[model samples]
Target: MHSPEIDNMAKLWDLIGDIRLAMFTTRHHNGHLHSRPMTTQNSRADHDTKLWFFMSRHGSPVAELTGEASVNVAYANPGKDTYVSVSGNATVVDDVAKKRQLWSKSAEAWFPGGPTDPDLALVRVDITHAHFWDVHENKLVQLFEMGKAAVTGHPAPKLGRQGEVRMA
Candidate 1:
């Protein structure tokens, strides 16, 4: 449970977990932004505001972040109509225990050496701020509301939720 008095990172974790994948964007030295799909390393632990990801140390994202840590991760679920955008500073760390903990058979396809692969690196994004949009009502109910509003010459009802989490 979360109270309005404090923004909870657990709630943010659940929201990000629901979406699963994030478009991790990083700035290149050429002053252009690049984005790549990344799977969030979801854990049961109540992380304050840090998100983890596994990637090859040789990857461009890792290289780019070495110079500038500022980055953004976007998550979207069109079917559920939920979306989130997070701004953070990413730092690469050599935490063998964490790599082992978050490891899975699926990751072996990328790093054949398994969790002990030297090329494999764990990047932690220290979230400074996060924004999310979600619809609470069922699809049918939301459609009905839209129809009603249209017939009454009124604006569409805002049936969802939106919030900003300043975690940093």
Candidate 2:
């Protein structure tokens, strides 16, 4: 069993694990933003939150990020009613050793050439800050607060957006 605080942190980690798909958005030179769903190659928590994703070096996203490092990563799990959005700078890494360490069979699906593929690229998102709302408990809390406010003729406090609210 975990303490209340630990339990909450564990829940957040679970939510992130449940949703492996991330919508990565990047800005183009022309000032237009592009968003695409990319398979989360791997997600591990280190001293800092690091998300690894695989993409072709020649892909449009890669080209866009080369010029502009800003990006937004959004994840959603409808069945679990969880969502996470992370905003950070994307850095393109083509280190063969690092790619080998992160490579897996699933990645082979996209990169037939494996980690040695000259076109393979890794984008690492260094999350600065994140916010999350657990609908499971938040919905109940909201109802309770609303009822109390109704009886006391007071307004309920505003809640931030669901998932990781990144301000960068």
Where in model 1 is the C-alpha error above 4 Å? 1-7, 147-153
For each candidate in turn, give its C-alpha RMSD to the true structure in angstroms: 2.5, 5.4
Query: Which digits, one per residue and each the tens of the lDDT, describe model 1 over residues 42-114?
Result: 5666356788988999999999999899999999987888889999999998989888888878788889999
Clashing pairs in 2: none
Clash numbers, per candidate: 0, 0
Q: Which whole-number lDDT from 0 to 100 does residue 11 have in model 1?
A: 66
Give the 10-residue window scoring lowest on summed lDDT in candidate 1. 1-10
Query: Pick by lDDT: which candidate is best?
Result: 1
Name the 10 consecutive residues with the lowest summed lDDT in model 2. 159-168
- Quantify all predictions' global Cα lDDT against the true fold: 0.86, 0.74
Q: Write the residue-wise lDDT of candidate 2 on 40-132 in tens digits.
A: 766464213567789999899999988998788878876555677667788998678778888888889889999998889988876655556
